[model samples]
Target: MMKEGGCRPRAASPLKWLTQRPTRVTRAWCSGPASPAPADLWSTLKKALFIIGSSTIVFVALRNSLTYHLQHFWGASGDFWQHQWDKILHTYGDNPFTFMVYGTTIVSYVVYWTVGLLYTFVDMTGYPAILKRYKIQPGTNEPVETWKLIKCILWVNFNQIFVGVPFSMACFYLLRLRGWDESRQLPTFHWVIIELIICILMEEIGFYYSHRLFHHRMLYKHFHKMHHEWQSPISITAIYAHPLEHALSNMMPVFLGPLLMGSHVATIWLWVSLALLSTLNAHSGYHLPFFPSPEAHDFHHLKFNQCYGVLGVLDLLHGTDDKFRASKCFSRHLMMLSLVPPREAYPDVLPKGKVIRGKQCYDQPSEDSQ
Candidate 1:
């Protein structure tokens, strides 16, 4: 069981702390080789097909209806965008590689730090009573020292600057050599939508398999353990990982789809921005009103396993999310519609006698209260 502050007892020495094995409690929650048999292949495949089919149908329907309108809008604003593009190309020596490198880097950091700092502020202050009540793992953030947060920030920046940029440069060079286009013309809305859908699917597959692989006994300690240090993660912790894990699991999956498709620099920029925002929200640890619940990923951190995929489809297929599916957090996964605390908004999921705002909700509560 986790201690009061949701942390394990610290080792006497820093080296020991770094090298210590997971406790029995942690092992129990992990989806190692000893876990129960996964769902039958046929059934899992059927579910996957159903999900894909339904999503495709919905997207096609929307595309059919909205494509023309979107195309019209783009056509209307074509000149403005064309001028902007020309200015960018002219200023950047007409080099798509330079444009992509600078543009994506700026956009990614802007979105990451802008949203990350907001969530960090919330964690630090626990302000705006409504947001505080929605804290998934109450009291976990309380013990995080300011120095530790600074270290996390510094490490994340170091990885991005030294590791991420070079990887991106190399990938872009390979892609160009592979005949990837650097067309000056903007892509149609229809093609952009199609490419984005493909990218999302590819990312899901790549991330699911790679993440599960990293959790293997031999690899976890070396490559992925650093990331799990934040069981109750804040937004910035989304990229706080070992450099190898960052390159393989975090960066590779995202770039895989775009690279294969030979996507335009602008499209890549947009995709990276959206992907960064999605991750920031997932790791933000708040189920704020009007936003998708971060409960799935939050539970992943707390338990050290399960909910291993972004869209949950792969987890459902491999039976990795069986425990998560049975948990109260699953029921509470919908986007929240109110500013009220989760304890109030999702009373059914809250254990009886669990304290919320200093009051017990029921007379008898489960010992393992969230």
Candidate 2:
């Protein structure tokens, strides 16, 4: 058998084998034989509960502390809540609501922008290598252009702080002026949680329909196509869209539940902040194990007309993700690997597309296809 050419079958390298069989490791780490077993689901739920619970606790404590300091600073010595209100009334008189709206807007901006900056710093500095390693399926790793990023930021701010907030405040003041709300008691923690859940459900429903509509040929070009410019997106890309799209799809869904519930102002602030954080986390390209993966949503961005929901529940029910599943890229195993920098980034691995769906890759023929 020691015949002609000593061409023996080469042993597969460990890296090659892992790349070929990435799902094997993912299944062992995050699931069972079935797709995301009960244990896996429970683990994700527990993590979310812990984060929300812990953050709420810290936020309440800090707010109380700050209020106390502010009251003392103003030389007020009386009931805490009464003292703060009295001070605001004394200072702003008939325009207290104006000040309240301005304060909330400014505070929300500070929180949202602070979180955005931190994520940017982390990805740009310490974790660039880490981001590359675990990036979902191979795609572009190059940074988005500064001008494009600026456009996204400016448009988002214009919609959120300028248009959305003032419109919301006007509606709220009108409702109060008309004496529509009846229940005027301090809200309990249970009420906040319930309202938060309602808000999420509303977002899931509203965003699902609005997103699907935006993908239609008639509306896509005018309203939502600009957001599709980035096939592989970063965290800041979450709010990057036309102003009307932001209003219809992003802001309205989030605020609808709170508005209907007449939720406590504190609960509204907390829920809005959390929703912003959630969206930012979703658009963030990294797929850390402890955190929920952005693979599904990111896949939607990479491959249009699929997974068009705030959460995947609606998509699953409607079979919107079937094509994504068939692509072999939507596996949980690949999502878990999304945290690691790829062995090689896109272009080296495979060609990109204007839109990629299952076996077919399509080019942007017109503005609508973008």
Give me the candidate number with maximum TM-score.
Answer: 1
Q: In the order shown, what is each candidate's alpha-carbon RMSD?
A: 8.3, 14.2
Give the backbone clash total of model 1.
0
The clash count of every prediction, one per candidate, is 0, 9
- Writing each residue's lDDT as its tens digit, candidate 1 over 1-370 gives 5555354543344533222233344534443333322335568779989988998799788976678787777667657666777787777776777766766777788889999998888788766555767777666685357987998999899778787788788878878877675888776677888888888888998898888878887899998999998877889999999999998999899998789889988889888888898899999877777887887888788777778888888887766776676666676788877667665666644454655432122222346753
TM-scores for every predicted model: 0.81, 0.63
- Model 2 lDDT, residue 34, Cα: 37
lDDT of every model, 2 decimals: 0.76, 0.63
**TM match of model 2 to true structure:** 0.63
- Candidate 1 runs further than 4 Å off: 1-39, 68-76, 338-342, 348-370
The C-alpha stretches of model 2 lying farther than 4 A from their native spots are 1-96, 122-128, 137-141, 174-185, 333-370
